[model samples]
Target: MDLNLIALIMGIVEGLTEYLPISSTGHLILVGSWLGFTGETAKIFEVFIQLGSILAIAVLYRHRFYSFLTLAQFQKKGLNLLHIFLGILPAAVLGFVFYDWIKTLFSPYVVVFALLAGAILMIAAQLAKRKVTAESLDQLTYRQAFLIGLFQTLALWPGFSRAGATISGGLLLGASYKTAAEFSFLVAVPIMFGTTGFDLIKNLDVLHPQDFGVFAIGFVTAFVVAMLAVVTFLKVLNRLKLIPFAIYRILLAGVLFYYLYF
Candidate 1:
């Protein structure tokens, strides 16, 4: 496949999976490999293009973030900034500490096992009885936020979805599904931005003159598709169960394992 075509397909995959309980990085790695889009440039492309998806969230939730700039509102709420920082801390710290090691685990076999493990975790989270203590994002306590961050650390593994880990943690801590998903999307802004910025700075030399066209295609594709995915996901979440996603992950893992190992 051509590089531009590969970028478009992977961008679509990233947009669709980024906010879902399925791993975007895992899907990108798998799809990129299958499309022969592997290597340093491809990895950097994947990292940088996540900025586009982050922009989707920024655009969609601009009102919420806008309120943070007002002094009166800031005084009353003290900014969810504190909680958001607490939530992203574990993953940020640990991811940086073990960056190289995590990169090594990005192979197809590791991702296969990770997908299976993550599926089981999601299935278990679905089956577990949840008490709706925190029904809204504002109602979530600091402790819950911290715990959710710890859960997010699980996503350092390729196939362990950040949304999945946080949502499961939120559910286990008695948050409603709506609140859990909302919080997941909100917290992802900082995390994605931080990671992407770090990677971009570290690999600035990886860019070539020809890369901009493909990157722009990916960025736009991800932005448009992510908006659609987020809208549709929130609309149907109340009527849907996480079990189906888990089942889909399991099936995907099995298929990949068969082709890779058989």
Candidate 2:
């Protein structure tokens, strides 16, 4: 297949999955594996292309961010900042500490197992009975914010979706479904940017000139698709539950395992 075609497919997949409770990294790794596109450069390309989805979130939530910056809302702003900070801290610390080890587990076998485990957890979260108290992001307490962030650390394993972990965690912590999804998206902005930015700086020299076009195509495609996905997902959030996504994950894992490992 043409490199450009590969980029297009990947970009579409990334955009569609990045914000969903389905793992974007898991899909990327699995898709790349099947496409025979795995290697150091491919890994770097994946990291760099996530910027597209990050941009979508930034654009979609720009108004909320502007509110956070208002002078009169300084106290609320401070609390918001603290919430975001605490939410991302556990992942930052754990990812930095296990960077190399985490990379090693990016293989198909690990992804398959992680997918199954995460799917089970997602289903369990849906089934668990918990009173919903946090109806909005502003209503989230610091402890709940911190715990949600802690749940995000589970996403270091590729098949464990970041959105899934945080959203499920939010549900377990008494947040409404909409509030959980919104917080998951908000926290993703910083986490994706921070990790992708670091990787880009560290690997900039290794990127090839020929690959720049592919990267651009993937990035643009991801951004456009992600924008559409974000809007659609939000609309359906209240009507749908995580069980469907969890089931999809399990089915995907089963198929991939048989095809790749059998």
Candidate 3:
């Protein structure tokens, strides 16, 4: 395979859409199809690029992550970690058990539906925003976290972006936009890292040292791009409304529909 070109394409997509409400997986799949990247390779490319977004959030939120682990924030340090682990457990289980079937569902047309459906949900979330609590994730109950986890499982289906589903779930469950968005970003680290690590293990025999270099380039590129995405999104989100993103989703889906038929 042409590693450099692959790195460049995946890096750009990973950087650009990883933080947005739009399904990053869906965009990668669409880009893959347009570029003729198919089968296992395409899935590998998509999953690997996801690591970039995860790393970006980890770096950007390093202070929060450190505080969450330290004695300063927690009376019982070990217990805090356990809660985080427990929250990640459900998604991990689901990923392992249904991994193959989930990837098989990726298609451009499904992305169109997901984009449109998610937009409608975003609009509804906007309306519902009035009733939501302004509670932070630290104030979140365990039951609420588990509910978000269940909602996250929906993202395993193509088009239902993980961040999109989780954020909407959080909002509906009473978390404010800032809290929901921040926690949603934090949860991504484990999910993406686990996914990338597992794929690397399964493909170890096939991955030569040069493949590692290519992966590194793509990983670094994705990280840089995602950092920018994270920063810009936070700023835009704080000052503006989610209506802009909702509109973007509708417009993108409309374009996809046109492309589908024309």
Candidate closest to the true structure, highest lDDT: 2
TM-score, model 3 to reference: 0.85
What is the clash count for each candidate, in the order shown? 0, 0, 0
lDDT for each residue of candidate 3 in 121-210, tens digit (9 for 90 to 100): 777776773555546667766666777777677677677677777777777878778877777787778877887788867866655565
Candidate 2 vs candidate 3: the lDDT winner is 2
**Which whole-number lDDT from 0 to 100 does residue 31 have in model 1?**
86
Relative to the true structure, how large is the alpha-carbon lDDT of every model? 0.85, 0.89, 0.74
RMSD value for candidate 3: 2.9
Candidate 2 structure quality by residue, lDDT tens digits, 75-193? 54334677888999999999889987987887777888888888988898999999998888888989999999999999999888999999999999999998999999989999999
After aligning candidate 1 to the native by TM-score, how far in Å is the CA of 174 from where it should be? 1.0
As for model 1, its CA RMSD to the true structure in angstroms is 1.5
Better candidate number, 2 or 3, judged by TM-score: 2
